[model samples]
Target: MSDPVDRPGASGVPEAVATPRSRWRIQIIWLVPLIAVLIGGWLAAKAIVERGPTVTISFETGEGLEAGKTKIKFKNVDIGVVKSVALSSDHRRVIATAELTREASPLLVDDTRFWMVRPRISGGTVSGIGTLLTGSFIGMDVGNSTKPRHDYTGLEIPPVFASGVPGREFILKGADMGSLDVGSPIYYRRLQVGQITSYQLDPDGKGVTMHVFVNSPYDKYVRADSRFWQASGVDVSLDATGVKVNTESLVAILIGGLAFETPDDAADDAEAAAKTQFVLFHDRAEAMRRHDRIVDTYALVFKESVRGLAVGAPVDFLGIVVGEVVAINTRYDPVAKQFSIPVEIHLFPERFTSRYTKGDQGAGGRLTADRQKLAQTLVDHGLRAQLRTGNLLTGQLYVAVDFFPNAPKGKLDWSANPPELPTAPGGLQSLQESVTSLLAKLNQIPFGGIGKGAQKTLTDADSLLRQLRTDVVPQARDTLAAAQTALNSANGALQPDSALSQSTSDAMTELARTASAFRSLADYLERHPEALIRGKQEDKK
Candidate 1:
């Protein structure tokens, strides 16, 4: 080799031996793999530190979810993203794998609820429609508990109180669930304040119980004696004040809803506790009937039929409603064996009576004593309960309490479970009885005999008139003609140029001539011997 350091030895060129320079001789290809491994390891460590709990959710459908795209949200804020979606083992549902951010780690808990938010229509209301443009996503509803967890079953139905919708929940029980459903609006007065969350038939099968939510400020209006009514559709009433129309709102008219009002002595400022049960009425009028909460029960035994009178008929005191009929039953006396209607009514004196009284006793005692005293006074002054016609067209009946001084006397019975009040006949019943009596008297009249006698008398009068017209009229006409001829003769005799009028004038002239001769004789005699005194006055002429 010519020079070892400068050798082209493989091709037979000269090799040169010179000082060998040491080099940093690691392969860059191997370095690339090493640097990639270090970088990947660091990334893996960072990912491990940052990764939140992985949750797998089973859904009925994978309708709106896409791997690496779909995100979980709470109150419109993003918290996690879907990593993968696959069919469940049984192929019945979709199992979604989601990677939650570390910040959302605490959301997984026992009561934490999850559900897919999508456009849905319920109770004539459109909701979640905003998701149509934004694409569907998972919704996480935070729970009430503080316990940290990592697994949860998603809700099929949306929650009523979403994230921060401030409100309290209550249950309403009614005889029937009429046009009410989930998401039905709850109204205070006529405003849309809250919604009906859920409902179910009462376990005892007595009624339907609905779970409702009353939102923030409006919830404070509900009180212990607040009246809730189904303010749905149109309510038209024809009463003494003519036709009346009542509706809560246009929304309530279209889709059914509930409305509430503080009626009696319940507080308005203090809120009723959550889950407090209330009775739901069919309409506002029905709810108002129970405004006076306290009831003083009384019984009235009516001898007449209690037909057309329902249990809810208004019990009025001098045209003002003071109570409602609770029940109507028949009782038979052992001795008389007569069945009489015993009407039980709840008399709410609180409607017209105040809690404070003359004495310093507690309200309860004062109310009791006042009621007793008033009852005794009423009984003494001939107070009685009677039925009256409320609607003449429908013949609907109502209970009326009034003083009847002319009523047959009866004593009150306070020892009974429901204190017994004296009763008079219903106004309608009395009217019917009077009409029946009149009909009976009418039936007793000899109508056929009267008609025959009237016909005979009419015929006799007709015959008499005919006789007068034919014979008597002619004879009277002849007599009147004779009298008229006599009157004409008398008129002719009194005429200015008639023979009788000439005779009378001649007689008057002869009398005047005789008088003149007598005057001449008297004048001669007076000249001689004051002849026969009175005759001398004619001499001056």
Candidate 2:
């Protein structure tokens, strides 16, 4: 006992106090952490349950889209948020991961479209302008189908009209699209009621095919035979009507537009079908006049040189254009064995048949009958084809159709399909005839014989002049000189004391005495009343 005390060195006042072992018991304080963990797990499960499916949208660019910030909207109502944005493997597009709410799950269909919304200009209008201030968001369009989808491709441009817009579509075929761009207005009598949805090149590449949308009410006015024209900007045309400035409105003059008008005589009962293609005229006049006139073709054989005549030359009737020369081809007349130039002219009637009877084929038949009757009447009226001068400055010739009273009496051969018109002497023919007549008159003169005679006459005249100058002149001079000498001698003989002067004085005295005696005898005879036939009565004085 002493050794154990020394080893332990126990210096206790009381022996070991016996204590009971404490039993393991549940503590309410530990349950606080467990309860908290359970509540957290439940909250996590509820959050996951409400969150909808995640979709991946591929876009060409992620300009304004940001992960964890951008929201997806429908009609401006946010329904989803972007989760992630990363470049695709090929780097051609940006892969956008978005989480859509459960309520929008049904909207994600095969035809659903998704696109990042930013301020953009489309169809000449501004849209998504609100995105400029607040921020950009994703836009979604619901599809008609019910099939759900997780992937979508974006639209480059917004649709012309949303799914709710009500309108009908039509197709217009034109030579060219002109200035009618996308969103160009469609005018009905200067009032805009529609717009151009799209345009593309025709399948055959010959023209442009425009996709047009005409709103209701206005579209009802379109008839089967209505005219459609491109009202693009301003149309300035010059014709007999003078300067025509045509524009539907100021807006049309800017961006361009489409216009339609039904002719007054057009059938109002027949309506144009949807997508029924119509020719889009560049001008309103052409559209209105397209089907109004009837065209007739005729061939004329001409013998004159058609050098100045060309295709597309006008065929005028009384200074009015009635036709155009389509072709000038050579033809051989077997019976005459002569090659002649045959001119084919396409004639549109000067006046259209105004009144058309009811029924489809009726109008056409009546038109043909009227044309045939008119042709017969014209032929009887001496309608003749001739080549005449059109432009004097250009020396261009055109075919002239006229009623000639002096045309070599001929008849039109209407038995042919394209009625053969009668021909007359063209301007060139008359000119040639005049030239030939002039040449014949010139050739009739015997120029050589006349020249010889003239030559001989001139020689004789020269000889006569020489004879007068030499022989006749010298002889006359000699005769004149001899006469003068003789006269001078006679003058000298007749002087005062010459013998001729004395003889003259004696003769004059005797004659005077004889006269006195005669007078006295006559007086005696008068006194004796009948002094009969006495030769002389002498009186002594």
Candidate 3:
């Protein structure tokens, strides 16, 4: 705190001193703009760094899309926004340009999927309802591919299921698509477990192929021996057991669906790999049929009408289904001048044979020679095939193979391409024959001659009754009058009065004396007769 002392110098009058000011000093007012500029620069750099890539999506139509309004979302989270919407050069499609967040950049790969989401109803499902209020948006499904892409195709229809869902895909080949469509339910034991993703007609135009997805953990149930069938509507069947109604679910009955089941006795329960191919049977019954490698094909020639029998009818051994009728044809026996129905059947011997193996086969998947011999032996023992009524109400018939001990002896006609198995008349046919024979016997009766003879007998009886009324009746009347007269005379004579009464009294007195004398004589005779033999014994008193 000391004050500076100035000493008197050479110029005492020049005491004033000059102090220098730095030119580099900034004004306080300028700092405000300078700080503002620095912050603005940093924000610009951040915007550049966070900016994502722009991509174009081609769609069939831009029905609900708008530039700068529609958003691209992944799992309901906004990931991008549409920057522009325009038509393609050919005017056949629409192209939408969108900007996605930087974080989503990695997901835009070769297989990434994009689609417009809006309220939609398909395959018995109602979805995207939220879009009805919030407006439509683009849905994105990330791909696993590493290759990046800038241009992509947008799906017109929303996927039945999203990517990353735990499941396995499968392909079903069938004669027809039936009632199936995208998003159609796939059922397991009547429970919905997945959906059909897509379908296409085969290149050769012979059949259809469908792709389906079964979600976890149900997917694990699909096995190599699994059978898939169309369970779209109410399946009604009439058989010997009576009418049966089956349906997978109410949904399936309305919108069509498919079902799969692995047989309990399936030789293989190994899980089927993804995209494994399977046959799509028309119905559960066909799907459930055993696929036996060793089959014995035979032809059964039936002499009677086969009106109720149909192809695909079950061939039964006892109560078990051992085969099915494959083909039915009519053949003419020129030598015998007769027409017969030849039914071709495929019999799976394994169905009836214990522990039969598929390897035990002869040429053309037929029964082995030893097995054929065994079949011949069975035929020798009266094994026969007969037509049987399966459903009386429906008049449906099926083939029944059984051992009829009384069946006539016959041999297998091996000369025929498909060996002919001996056949016996069906019970119905036998009944018809009996009825026909009885009718024939009834027709042979001499009913006309019997009617004439009865008429003659009736006429004769009528004549006899007329004669009795004319002659016998008058004679009987006269006889009755005479009898009445005789009765009157008897009444007068029997009266208890006059001389007859007096005479009767006297006669009675005389008869009593005579009776007493006779009695005495009888006693004497009795005693004398006894005495004659040995005199009467008197009692000693």
> Which prediction has the highest lDDT against the true structure?
3
How does candidate 1 fare on TM-score? 0.63
Query: 382-474 in candidate 2: lDDT tens per residue?
Result: 888899987889889988888977656666666886778888778779989999999999899999999999999999999999999999999
* lDDT by residue for model 3 (216-308), tens: 999999999999999989989899999999999998888999999999999988999999999999999889977886788999999998998
Q: How many pairs of residues in model 3 come into backbone collision?
A: 1
Give the residue spans of candidate 3 off by over 4 A: 1-51, 89-91, 173-181, 184-192, 200-208, 229-260, 280-293, 296-304, 318-320, 330-342, 355-386, 391-393, 402-541
Superposed by TM-score, candidate 1 places the C-alpha of residue 92 at a distance from the truth, in angstroms, of 10
lDDT minimum window of 10 residues, candidate 2: 350-359
Which consecutive 10 residues in model 1 have the weakest lDDT in total? 530-539
TM-score per candidate, chains pooled: 0.63, 0.58, 0.62
Compared with the true structure, all predictions reach lDDT values of: 0.84, 0.82, 0.90
Model 2 gets an lDDT of: 0.82
* lDDT string, candidate 1, 1-541, tens digits: 3666564575677667798766967766798889999999999999999988888888888988899988899778998999999998999988889989898877777678888888988776777898888888999888777887665566667776775678888989899978777888988868888999888888899999899999998888888778888988889999998999988778777778999988665545466898989889998888886465467999999999777899889899876788899999999998997889999999877655553666744665555558867677777788889888788899889898989898877776778888898987776678989999999999999999999999999999999999999999999999999999999999999998999999999999999999999998877886766546554454565
- Looking at model 3, the pairs that clash are 531-535
Q: Considering lDDT, where higher is better, how would the candidates rank from best to worst?
A: 3, 1, 2
